[model samples]
Target: MSNTPIIEAIKLSKQFTKDGDFVLNSLSLSIPKNKFTAIIGYSGTGKSVFLRQVLGLDRATSGIVRVLGKELHNMEPAELNAFRKNLGVVFQDSALFDDQTVLENVCFPLKEHKRSMSEDKRKAIGSEKLKLSGLNEEHFNKFPEALSGGMKRRVALARALVLEPKILIYDEPTTGLDPVLKQKVDELILTTHKRRSSSTLVVTHDLPSALHFADHIVMLNAGAVLFEGSVSEFLKSSDNLVATFREQGLNKYGKN
Candidate 1:
């Protein structure tokens, strides 16, 4: 619905500053306006940090982060609070409160972002989102600890969608789940984009899902964009590094 690039990062770089050594090097990549972008890279490559920066959860050292064309690198506290609502990030942990019911977790965002919305309305919308994420009514009253890992991720997805965000950032959407449920997550990610048409950015190592769900793919190493192109282009890349990485071959990913 927005006539803006959902996310734009220009020469983005973040340093973890572990004894003055930078964990993340210069990063530069822009997400497609209205499509699924899968960012795949090896572990310890600042994938989570990159997502955090884009969602305004963390700040970049000396680079720019623009969401919907609004600069976020040095936004004030109030500005960050206002800007965070436009992006929904489903962390690797699902980040659900174990004390709360599934429905409560899903409605948390709506209540935070739209305080005036009635409780009944929020609950109804939450239920709808859960159903969309392949969750049934019976799961709504259960707490996070009782649910399986996949179900928790579904609740997380529902929560991410609760705000009707223009951008949904998924971090390893299919990790640690059973094969069947991994397929479910892949379908859910693809279906969410198809249904809402929201700009989606996925930070994942799920190569198969990345190849399947992504309209475009960006392969990163040491926070640098090593390969940027369509999924098909990625598969057909002539670069040996791209081929080796995509194929999960012997590449160690150190020379980004």
Candidate 2:
């Protein structure tokens, strides 16, 4: 992997109107190219908010976010839209359209951005991604309402991969999965990253799973970076917050 940062945040800050303080304080971080980095923190620590800023879906109240070497907040709408074609995001909710068929949903990004491609070509690409996500042809015509939770998550992942993005972002990907399914998702992520070689960011509070796969980790506490290092460093560090999190996570998830 290269040393260049695929995503860089400089003094980023955010504050809601009703909140008295910054939900995300002045924080600077970088996600290196072709690496799997996990962002972990307690609830309400602005992990999702930080993701929104990186995605250019929300503007930072006081700093710069650069993705793929372009300043996100400063880009024009058309430019931002063009730039975003290279980013694939899997939301915490699996955000698939209930009204669309699985095939259509998987092909949505390609249809939106690669308009010149024929419908058959788009479906062909979507089919490839769906198979890669471990879904068979029989699942193609089903709607989101008809699928199981794990199936829906796989479809969402297929949709993300349809674009062949340079960066893949997962927001709480394993939130509601059972232990067995969670392992499947973890293996899926690791294998997908290996195949695609994308710079991936997983925003999750699931530390054991994060430690299982991540090359690096960034820990947030009270909206500030509490720790940043390799997985081994994160596991062995004596920092109070790291120790506390490690203990709690191990207790909850078991030492793996």
Clash count of each predicted structure: 0, 0
Candidate 1: 10-residue stretch with minimal lDDT? 247-256
Please report, in order, the local distance difference test score of every candidate based on alpha carbons.
0.83, 0.90
Query: 1-256 in candidate 2: lDDT tens per residue?
Result: 3677998888888987755789889888888888999999899888999999888999878988888888988889998998898889999889999899999999999988999999999999999999999999999999999988778889999999998999999999989998888888888888999998788999997888888889989998887788888999998899987898889987897674
Which stretches of model 2 miss by more than 4 angstroms? none
Indicate the residue-level lDDT of 25 in model 2: 90
| lDDT tens readout by residue for model 1, 1-256 | 5555677778887776746655557777778788889988888877888887877778887788788888886689888887777787788889998899999999988888889999999999999999999999998999999999999998999998888888899888888888899888888888899999878999887777677788989888877888888988988888877777766632332222
Residue 153 Cα positional deviation in candidate 1, in Å, after optimal superposition: 0.5
Q: What is the lDDT for 197 in model 2? A: 78
Off by over 4 Å in 1: 1-4, 249-256
